[model samples]
Target chain A: MAETVKLLFSATRETVYMVAVSVLIASIFGIPLGVLLYSTDRGRILENSPLNKALGTIVNIFRSIPFVILLIMLIPFTRWLVGKSIGTTAAIVPLSVAAIPFMGRLTETALREVDRGVIEAAQAMGASPFQVITKVLIPEALPSIAAGITITAINLVGYSAMAGVIGGGGLGDLAVRYGYQRFMLDIMLYTVAILVVMVQLIQVLGDLVVKYLSKHR
Target chain B: MIRIRNLTKVYTSASGTVKALDGINLDIEKGDIFGIIGLSGAGKSTLLRCINLLEKPTSGSIEIDGVEMTGLSPKELKEMRKKIGMIFQHFNLLSSRTVWGNVAFPLEIAGFDRKTINEKVENLLNLVGLSDKARSFPSQLSGGQKQRVGIARALACDPKVLLCDEATSALDPETTLSILKLLKDINEKLGITMVVVTHEMNVIKQICNKVAVIEKSRVVEQGTTFEIFSRPKTQTARNFLKSMFICEIPEELKAKIKALNGNLAEGRVVKIGFFGEITAKPILSEVVKKFGVNANILYGNIDNIQGTPFGTLVVQFEGKNGTADRALSYLQDIGLDVEVVEIG
Candidate 1:
């Protein structure tokens, strides 16, 4: 029982580390990508349809790939990136790669929800395109974007569990090794309970932030 | 302080080219509350947008304060736009910002320091009577208050010209009046030139000193509000002005006209339109006493246009021996527009 507790603790730490680092990295790249995607859309501020389509296709291709296959498929790239093919640190490469497009698409949708009239009002006030994005579009879309980030982070939690399949240590690795392989039902149940708690915490925290940011409240 | 010469905007889409504005020329002197009035799809909005170069013209020249607008670079245009403020019909206040933040948005874009932004926003909120609502979000305000925020934001840069694109079209009648009053007050207080675009004649009647009537993408007529109201020159202008009065033959009057159709020997119905000092004169009484005719007023509407009384009256003149005809002729001779209404 004591050994199981220790394993669960380490597994949770690994999972948290993977999800947090990947979400941060994903956001850094994903936000600008999302803005570019929205700006290049038809009739938008930048308005380059071809560029929008190209970027959309790339994001779609990455998003459509199953996370399981994406993890295995990115093994070589992951090996090259973090100098290892299987570990908690190396799993971040595949997790972040898969999550970047997910975050980008979500961010783009959040941006699209911003009122065009508000954007025009900004432009009429002599706001440059950058100002329109930073001042008007981003701030107006903040609540929605924050909600999207929460969703992406929660999704990363799930993806990080899957990353534990091939020696990428996390709760999923412990559940597979101790519960499925060794048939320790108690160990599996405890890990499953912890995962559920993590998900619920993320959702509750996200809802709180969204409620606070929403002005209609 | 704005001159638009042959300003045309052509929009080409999948279908074909649409001439939103064609050969539009306008001269708005400084401090003038110029109105561009037209029906829906008449290109009044396109003309207003052209002033700020929001809608690029197909072929034309716009000069504001003697600087050619169409020739400016993007950076220069941005700088020039600082002097021109615009308020939209929807009261496009940023939903994410408080009233103070929304008003400060323009100042921030103009790169004012934090202290200056705060002071300007304070003065602007006071100017628009929204100082108490500074911390409130736009969603918390009524339509009039939202527009007041829009007005304050537009004035934050101390713009030389203010463009109103149906600024009050979204408000209730009482609210519209208050917004118009505020706009007029701003105009007088700041001496800022204003260009107002709207389809509602009442909007033009209430505030516009000069008006340009656009029809089918062309400037059908342009003149002082008094001129357009008192003496509409074009057929389009006449038709547009006709909508202002309740001149349609009422149901009861229609029955009376039908009854007295062919049997009208020494009686006739005449629709008389008079304006300015003419409305002050009791011309109908003069005609009654002079021509010995009994003038029965069936329908009438007297309106005040820019301190001038403009009225339309439909009267049935009845008498024997052509006195009724002489009465109408006399009303015409006295500078009243008298049109003989056919009883059919």
Candidate 2:
């Protein structure tokens, strides 16, 4: 039982590391990707139909692949990135890749929800195309964008747990190795309990942040 | 001065092409309050948009302050747009921003230094009477207060031309009057050329020195507000003024006069429009005394436009034949514009 507690603590840290690194990585590229996808549509700010269509197709193709399949498929690339394909850092590669398209599409939806009249008012005030995006579009869509981020972050947590299926060394890996394979029911229930608690904390924190932001709005 | 000549705009969609503006020729003098009046979908808003190149005109020459705007490059056009301020019917104040921030946006766009922006925005907030609500967000404001923020924002860059696209149409009547007065004060104090587009005649009567009536994408008539109100040449203008309930009688009264067939004094409804001296002259009483014609006033509305007394009255004369005719002729001779609505 003491060994289980020690292992659970270590496993929880690994999962936190994997989720945090992947979410940070996904946000860095995914936000720009989403903005480009939205702005390059025909008659939009960037207004490149060909680029928009190609980018959209690529995001859709990636988004359609299952997370488990994506993780398996990215093994070689993950190995090249982190020098090993079976550890926690390696799991981040597939997780970040899977999160990119998901975050992009969600951010695009948030941007689309911004009022067109507000965009026009910015233009009428002589805002440059870049200023319209930075000042008006982004700020106006911020509340919805914050909500989208919460949804994405929650999804990434679930995805991080799934990473343990393939020897990624998180709570799921501990549960599968000691509980399922070793016939230890207590370990299985403990991992599940911990996962549920982490998800609850994420949800509460996300809601509090969104509520605070919407209040200022 | 803003000169728009031979302006035409066509909008093409997947369904079909619609001509929104056609051959719209207008010369709006600097410091004058101009109005463009039309019904919904009559291209009034479209015309206003074309002025700022928000809705680019298919063909036209728009010259403001000696610069032809239609031919400018995108960057140059954007630079030019900074001088042409616009307020909307919806009061398009940025919802996420405070009233001060909303007003400061344009100045910020123009890249004015922070200190200059603060001073100018402060002066503008005072000008529009929203200084007390500077920290308040748009959602917290009433429609009138939101528009006051909008007005302050539009004036932030010290624009030479201000375009109001039905600015007062969204507000209640009392709020509308206050906004109109603010606009009038702005026009007087800043001498910014104003082009207002609205469906209401009272909006035109309140501030516009010159007005153009639009119908079916054409400028049907253009003149001084007093001239348009006193003598509406086109059926569209007449119908428009009829809505104001000031110039023309109600349709029921018109039908009633049309149905009656009697002597000139008994049946004829004469529309008497006067400006200047006749408004003060009690001309109707004079006509009654001179001709012994019992002039029953059916409708009357008098207004002071630009410090000039202008009014219209529809009266049915009930007296002998030659006396009523001579009385009307005498009114015309005295320079009171008279139109016989239902001739007996």
Candidate 3:
């Protein structure tokens, strides 16, 4: 049991690293992608239907591929990116790729929820495209965006468990090897229980941040 | 001066093309409180939007101070819009921003330094009489207060032309009057050229120096309020002018007149509209004094709009003889809009 606890501690660290890195990287690419999706809509700020469609297709393609299949398919690309395909960093490649499109679509939905009248008012005030995005779109959608980010982070936590298929060191690997293959039900239960706690903590923390950001509150 | 010539806007959609404005031409002089009045979907809003290039014109040109806006590039157009401020029926104040923040947004976009932005926002807040609510979010304010914030936000950059789209339609009657008064004050003090779009007759009558009536994407009539009130040439203008004021006869008085007249068709209830210098001319007493034709003044509405006195009276002539004709002709000769109504 002491050895099992030791292995669980290291697996937990690996799990946190993979999810945290994936979400951070996803945010870097996904935020701009989401803004592009919303702004390029016909009659919107950028107002280019062709650009919107092309980006939308790319997002859809990434989003539709099953996470398990995506992890297997990205192995060679992951090897080239991280110089290895069977470690925590290698797991980040597939995890972030899966996360990017998911987070981007959420961001698009959040931006779309902003009042169109507010946007027009900004334009009437002579706000340029960049000013409208930074000052109006993002700020107005902040609470919704926060909630979306929380959801995306929680989803990344679940997706990271799939990284264990490629010998990635995380809670999923411990659960599959020690608990499933070695028939230790206690280990599997412990990992699943910890994952649930992580999800709950993220959700509560997110709700608080969103509530605080809300001006109407 | 702002001049628009032959402007047209067509919305081509999957359904069909909607000609929002068809050849709308207007000239708003500096400091003129111009009104574009029409029913919903009559294209008054479209006309106002076209002025600032919020909706790009499919044809025609808009010239502000002799600079052609239609051909201006996007950057130039944006710079031009800095001189044109717009408010809306919904107020459109950002929910995420405080009243001060919302007001500061325009100035910030113009790249005003922090101190200048602070001073300008303070002055605008004072101008709109919302200094006490600077820290309040838009959702926490009343409708009138929210509108005041919207006005302040629009004025933050000290725009030369202010466009109001049904700015008072969302308020109560008392609130509407106060906001209208505020707008009039802003116009007079700042000398800002205001272009207002509204369907409320009182809104037009109370504030507008000049009005253009739009019908089916075309301006059917455009003139001073006094001219439109006194002589409406088009059927659409006449329809709008007829019921504009508080002209409803009290039910008790209508019944009393009907009882006294004894005959429904023969009762002489004339709805007389008088405007300009003629409202104070005492035309009714003149008819009574000259023809001795007992003119009973029953009900009327007298109002002073933009320093012009406009009146509508429901008068009962004692006798249904040709005296009514003479009186009407005399009234017409004196520049009064007179109509004979059959009262039963």
Candidate 4:
């Protein structure tokens, strides 16, 4: 029982680390990618159809790939990146790669929801394209973008669990090794309970932030 | 001051090509509340946008204060745009920003320091009468209040010219008047040139010193507000001022006219327009007495336009010996516009 407690504690820490670091990395790359996708589309500030289409196709290909297959497919790149093919740290690569496109698509949608008139108002005031994005577009879309980030974070939590399939250590790895392989139903139930609690906490916290950021109320 | 010479804008879509503006020419003096009045789809908005190069004109030249707009580089255009502020029909205030932040947005774009931005925003908010609502978001304001915020934001850069794109179309009648009053006050206090584009004739009537009537992507008429109101040359201008003219012959009057069967010996219906000192002089009565014609007044109303009293009267002239024709000619001779409505 003591050993089980220690394993659960370590597993929870690994899952938190995987999800947090992966989300952080995904956001850094994904936000600019999203802004590029939005601004390069036809009729936008930085309109360039060819670049927008190319970026769109790349994001779509990544987004359409199944997470399980993506994990295996990214093994070589992951090994090259982190000097290891399997572990919580290495799993972040595949998780972040999959989430980047997802996050980008969502962030684009959030930005697209901003009013066109507001954007024109900014332009009329002599705002450069970069200034428009940073000052007007992003700030106006902040609440929706925050909501998108929340959804992306929740998706990362799920993806982090799947990272366990490749010897990536987390609660899912603990559950599979002890509950599935050793037939310990009680341990599996404990991991499921913890996952549900983690997801709930994330959702509640995200809603609070969204509510606070939303000035439309 | 703005001078637009043969400015044209052509729009092409997958469906076909459209000429949004064709050979528009205008000369607006400084401190003038110039109005572009047109019906929907007449391209007045496109013309207003052309001033700031928001929609680049397809051909011709636009010069503001002697600087050619069409030839300006992107950076120079941006600098030029900073001196020209615009307000939208939708009152496009940033939803996420407080009134203070919204007003400060233009100052921020102009790269003013934080202290200057604060002081400028405060002065602008006071100018627009939104000082108490500085901390409130746009969603918390009414349509009129939102437009006040829009005005405040537009004035933040101390722009020399202000463009109003149907700025009061979204507000109620009372609110529209209030906003117009504010615009007039701003124009008076700051001596800023203003270009207003609107379909509402009342908008032109209320504040415009100079008005250009646009029809079918072309400038049909351009003159002082009183000139256009007192003597509308084009059919479009006449149609727009129809409500102001009260030329609708009463049903009873129409029946009375129909009873005469186009007999020259009986009477004729004439619509006479009087402007400025003409309204004060009893010219219609004098014409009747001089021509030996009996005049029956059908409809008449005096309107004060730009401090000038302009009135229109529809009357039935009963006389023998071709005196009605002489009376009509005499009215036309004395600078009165006379149109034969019905010959009875």
Candidate 5:
């Protein structure tokens, strides 16, 4: 029982690190890509139809691929980039790649929900496209975008656990190594409890942050 | 001054072709409050959008202040758009911006210095009677207040022409009156030509000196407000006037008037419309004394159109058969429009 508890603690830390790092990378690339998708449509102030469609198609294609298959397929590339594809650090490459498309789609949806009239008002005022996007669109969409980020963060937590199946050092790996292989039901139970706790903590924090950021609140 | 020649816009949707504006030709003289009245789908809004090239016309030319807008490049179009202000029915102020920020937007886009922008924004907010709402967001404002901000922002560049696309349609009656008065004041004070598009005759009556009635993507009637109201030429103009003024005359009221008056052969009921200085003259008394016809007043309405009094009187004439005809001739001779109505 004591050994089970120790394994659960280490696995919980690994899962937290992987989820946090991957979400950070996803946000960096995904938000800008999403903004680009929004501004580059036909009739938009900075319209470039081909570019917008191409980026949108690429994001969609990546999002449609199963995350488990993506992790396996990215193993060779992950090894080349990180010099290893087994640990939590190497696992981050696939995790963040999977998250980018997911986060981008969420960000795009959030941004699209912003009122077009607001953008027009900005343009009618003689604001450049950049100013409209930054000062008007982004600010108006911030609350929805923040909620989207929370959704992405929670999704990444689930993806990170799946990453453990490929020998990635997280709670799922700990469950397989010390619980499944050895038939230690107590270890599996403890690992499951810790993961539940982690997920619940993230969800509560996300809900609170989203509520705080919302105008109605 | 704004001039549009053969301005056309065609939208080819999946279903087929829709001609939003078909060869619209208009010349708005300087300092005239021109009103374009039309029903929904009448292309009035489309005409206003074409002025600023918001909805780029498929063909034709738009010249504002003698500069052909259609010929300008994109950069030039943007620059020219700064000098042609437009407001919308929805009061499309940026929700993310405060009242002050919304007013300052155009100035910032014009690349004014921070201090000058601040001073101008303050003055504009004060002008709109929203001086205390500088820091308040659009969500915090009422419909009237939001539209006032729209007005202030549109005036930010101090354009020579202001295009209003049903600018007061969203406000209550009292607020609409105040906004109309404000626009009239602005027109007089700044001498800015305003092109107001609305379906409401009241709006046209309140501020427009010149008006054009559009129907089915075409200008069916165009002239001074007095000319259109006093003598509507087209069927479209007559229909609009009937709906605007006589909508309150219920079917029961018409039936009662018919029952009380009997058949048309007994007497002649004429509708007389008077405008300007002619309204003050006791024309009814003069007609009775001059033509020896007994004139019984039935229904009457007098309204001020752009500070000029326009009056309409429905009266029944009783006496000799030829006396009614002579009375009508005398009324017309005295410069009052007299249209004889057939009683059923």
Candidate 6:
């Protein structure tokens, strides 16, 4: 029973590390790409149809691939990039790759909700397109975008657990090695409880953050 | 002054084509409060948008202070737009911005320094009687207050002309009047040319010195408010005036009168339109005394148009057979419009 608790704690820590690192990397890249995707469309400020369509299609294709398949497919690239593919650190490459497309879509949805009339008001004030994006669009969409980020982080947490299937040292890997294969019911029960607690914590944190950020409420 | 020549705008929809503005030509003098009035889908909005190039005309030339706007380069067009301010029906202030920030937006776009922007925004907020609301977002303000913010923001750049597109339609009548008064005050204080588009004749009557009535994408009547209301030329104008005056005997009323008044003759009914000073001098009494015609007022409406009184009266005349014709001629000679109506 003690052994099961120790393994569950270690798996929980590793899962947290993977989710944090991947979500950070995803946000770094995804937000700008999402803004580009939103602004560079027909009738928008940038209005480059071909560029917008090409980038949008690429993001959609990446998102359409199931995360499990994506993790396996990214193993060789992960190893080549990170010098190993067996630890939680190595799993971050696939996790961030999956998270970027997810976050990008969320960000696009957030930005799309900003009133077009607000954009026109900015333009009527003689604001350049760049100023409109930086000053008006981003500020207006901040709350929704923050909520979107929270949703992305929660999704990354779930994906990080799936990473344990490929020998990434997280809760899922511990459950498989000791609980499933060795038939240790005590380990399985402990890991499942910890996983539920972690998901609950994340959901509560996300709800608080969203509530704090929302201006409408 | 602003001049729009040969202005045309065509919108293509999935179903068919709509000519929103067709060959519109207009000249608005500087410092004039001009009103463009029409029903919904009457192209009044389309015409107003063309002034600021918000809705680009298919083919036309717009000249503000003798500078052509139609063919300017993109950079120049941006600069040109800064000289023409506009307010909308929805008070399209940014929900995310405070009143101060909204008012300062144009100055910021103009790249004014922070100190100058702050001072200008403060002044504008005070000008709109919203200094206390400088930090409040638009959602916290009432409709009239939101529109005041919109007006202040549009004025931030100190544009030479202000285009108002149904700016008061969303407000309650009392609020609408206050906003219209504010617009009039702005015009008087700044000496800025103002063009307002509205469907309400009362709006035009309140502030507009000159008005153009648009119908089916054409200007059916364009004149001073006095001329348009007093001598409406087109059938559409007459119909619009009927509603405004509310004294034009309807077909139902005429039928009822024929059935109710058995003594009424075929040519005894007439409608009279009186304008300005003529409405004050007991013109009906003058006609009655001079022609020995007995006047029975069936309907009457008197309204003020831009501080000038205009009136309409529908009456039945009974007298010696020839007296009715003499009374009609006498009214006409005194500058009243006398339209004879059939009676039983």
Clashing pairs in 6: none
- Put down candidate 5 lDDT per residue, B1-344, tens digits, no spaces: 78899988999989999998888899899999999999999999989888887778999999998999888887787788788888889988766678898888888888899999988898888888999989888888888999999999999988888999999999999999999999999999889999999988889888999999998888888999988887789987887777667523456756766875675455677778888998888888888897788888888888777667887888888767688888888888878878876547
Which runs in model 3 stand beyond 4 Å of their true positions?
Answer: B246-267, B319-335
Tens digit of lDDT per residue, candidate 1, span B180-224?
A: 999999999999999999988888899989999999999989999
TM per model? 0.96, 0.94, 0.94, 0.93, 0.93, 0.94
DockQ of candidate 2 (2 decimals): 0.66
lDDT of 3: 0.88
Q: Candidate 4 — which residues are off by over 4 angstroms?
A: A1-4, B250-253, B256-265, B284-295, B317-333
Q: Write the per-residue lDDT of candidate 3 for residues B88-134, one digit (tens) a residue.
A: 99998888889999999999999899999999999999988999999
Worst 10 residues of 2 chain B by lDDT: B259-268
Question: Which candidate leads in lDDT?
Answer: 4
Error of 1 at B13 (Å): 2.1
TM-score of 1: 0.96
Docking class of 4: medium
- lDDT per residue (tens digit) for residues B20-111 in model 2: 99999999999989999999999999999988888889998999999998998989988988998999999887877899999999998889
Model 3 vs. true fold: TM: 0.94
Clashing pairs in 4: none
Q: What interface RMSD do all candidates show, one decimal each?
A: 1.4, 1.3, 1.1, 1.1, 2.6, 1.9
Can you write out model 1's per-residue Cα lDDT over A1-217, one digit (the tens) per residue? 7998999999999988898899999999888899999999988989998899999999999999999999999999988888889989999999899989988988899999988878887887788999999999888888888898899999998888788765788888888888989999999999999999998998899889988998652
Which candidate has the highest DockQ of all?
A: 3
* Off by more than 4 A, model 5: A1-5, B247-250, B263-266, B320-322
Instruction: Please report the candidate that would top TM-score against the real structure.
Output: 1
Better of 4 and 5 by DockQ: 4
* Of candidates 6 and 2, the better by lDDT: 2
Q: Write the per-residue lDDT of candidate 2 for residues A102-188, one digit (tens) a residue.
A: 888878888887777777777888888898898888888777777777787879878887887567889888888888999999999
In candidate 6, which residue ranges exceed 4 Å CA deviation? B12-17, B265-267
Provide the overall lDDT of each model, using Cα atoms, as 2-decimal numbers: 0.89, 0.87, 0.88, 0.90, 0.84, 0.85
Model 3 residue pairs with clashes = B264-B344
